[model samples]
Target: MTNQLVPTSGSPERGIIVPVPHQRPEHFDAETQERLNRVDDAAFEAIAEGRPENTVTAYGQDWAAWEKFCAETSVPVLGVTPGTLVWFVEWLWEQPGKKAGTYTAPSTIARRVTGVTVSARVDHKVKLEEGVARPARARLTQLKNELAKTRETRGRGKAPALKIPHLQLISAALPDNLRGIRDRALMLIHFSIAGREHELAWLRNRHITRTDEGLVVDVAVSKNHPRIVGIPYGTRLATCPVRNWDAWKTAVEELTGEPVDPDEFAFRRIHAKGKSLMAGGITPEAVGDVITRCGEIAGLDIRLTGHSPRRGFATEAVKKGKEREAKRQGGWSKTSRAFEEYVEEAGIFEENALHGIGL
Candidate 1:
């Protein structure tokens, strides 16, 4: 008999229809079923642990976007074909994006295809044929090549590379206030740890380990990998991320007359004109906003994004001939084209062999 979906709760909304993976077909006995049930339980736990939270969110959003695409164009949600994937990529080119007058990015379009693929295999339990996806992948590759040749987006309103000097300038201009204290700490720790804004937002006092030399922060990178990032003591206490972090915590305790909870988020929403705190953690968007706000306060004319720190960290590492270490620290897989861009940015001019030979 085929393995059956068993309900754990009475209502459908309340944990009904749980999955049982790899249940044996010949396990008709009650004892065998119970043994398979234990195995299935472990399998479910592994499934949950396998994917990182950020990836989970992105994949969810990607699937939702696919559904939206299907709704708009009257395509079947699971009826994925090479033609349909190509159509989705073409449709994305017409949709509005964050960039003014631009459609979806090449990178985003590629990721959306991955979302549909995952949704088909996992949620719908249908493995897409290799033949069906290969053509679409080829088409996407061609499109990227075409765009590179055309240079349609050559430095037009593109956010500049956020280097160490830019951050130092922003740090120097931060106000000596509660909100500023939090912002400064946030930006510095974010860059030092080379984490995504979401990761930074999720950080709590519990992740911090203060030592005589510096601070050790346990950061959760993408794919749920945990890493220890060190922030050594700075020559100047005023600009030190560790000291600033401690000061912010101390200031919060003094203001509320209570020690910060280990489970509490490191960054929280500020109220009363940025002088007081609100409940719950600061959002991922707010983490990015702090960086942009700091830049604006420092009179920077360049645009900055939440992802700048991660890119900056990678580039800086590449500059120091530590590209592999940067890739590992930034949670980038060996085959990530996005991470390759950072490596290129760091070496494009610095590594040019014609630099001294030409002049």
Candidate 2:
């Protein structure tokens, strides 16, 4: 005889039965779902939404750190509370060593916090359909409030201006060689152009155009916008022009040994004894190396880099700007916000202010 509730032989209910929760396949709640969704979306958007490459790389690093933290703590991202975020910030603060300490700058911390918050929000929202409830809006508010406080504490203080004597001394002591000549030219151009490292690296021979007025450099890519800079004939070099410009031109011509097309790179690799030595073009890191080597040769214990040229140019321009024409030749764009930074970094404004009073 077969029981009514229990199946007997050949009945459909003869096998063992298991139960499954339809809403929660993995047993994750709404908060977890939202956090997961938010992280995924943020990463995808950062890459796909035309964000700058540097920004994307930075966000990727922040996301990786957050993921590691969550995995170690066994905490679902959506369930991360303000308290947890505070701990993360504190962890960042205690990251150890100068590199890590510097990494905890206010801007860096803010980005990391933003990454985590976005990830949590997305994951929570996505899981809501599975019966997971959205987190209260107040939690987000609290997280932001905490982040603001941390930012206030982490804001960077003004650093002292890089010294001019240090730069002048270093420039004077650079070793005499083809590499040195190239470095010196790069230094001069960097200062004269107030160019970023990447811009300097990408400079081509065709970019330098000779107009009736003077030598004009057409900056295709710059921090603010594409612009043209002209250097008049009267500009004097502190060092010998033969070593600075003439030698550079000769070296470049020798390397190419032929008429170079306009699109070709102005700088090329130099060869010695039939083997290529150093290639031309400057990288951002190379700029720093040049400064360091110059410092070592000069026996000066100061931080210097390609940026020093820019600072030196601005400082000297503001000092020599008793005449309006001199100030105009400094290549400063009044319209750009970066002008203020360069001015401040060079301390040119302060120098000019003091000079105005004949102090």
Which candidate comes out best when scored by lDDT?
1
Worst 10 residues of 1 by lDDT: 153-162
- Sum up the clashes in candidate 2: 15
TM-score of each: 0.79, 0.55
Clashing pairs in 1: none
> Per-residue CA lDDT of candidate 1, range 1-359, in tens?
33555545566545434445664567568887788767766765676467776777888988888899999999998888889988887777667887577667777878888877876766565547777667667787877788889877412234456677887888889887898888888887887787888889888888887898888888854444678777887667656788888888888898889999888888878896977899988878788888888888988878777877777877888899987777666667788887788888889889898898968
Task: List model 2 lDDT by residue over 135-177, tens digit each.
Answer: 3233434544776788643323332223456545655777556
List runs of model 1 lying over 4 Å from the truth.
Answer: 1-49, 154-159, 221-224, 321-328, 332-340, 348-359
TM-score between candidate 2 and the true structure: 0.55
RMSD in Å for all candidates = 11.3, 13.4
lDDT of model 1, residue 204: 83
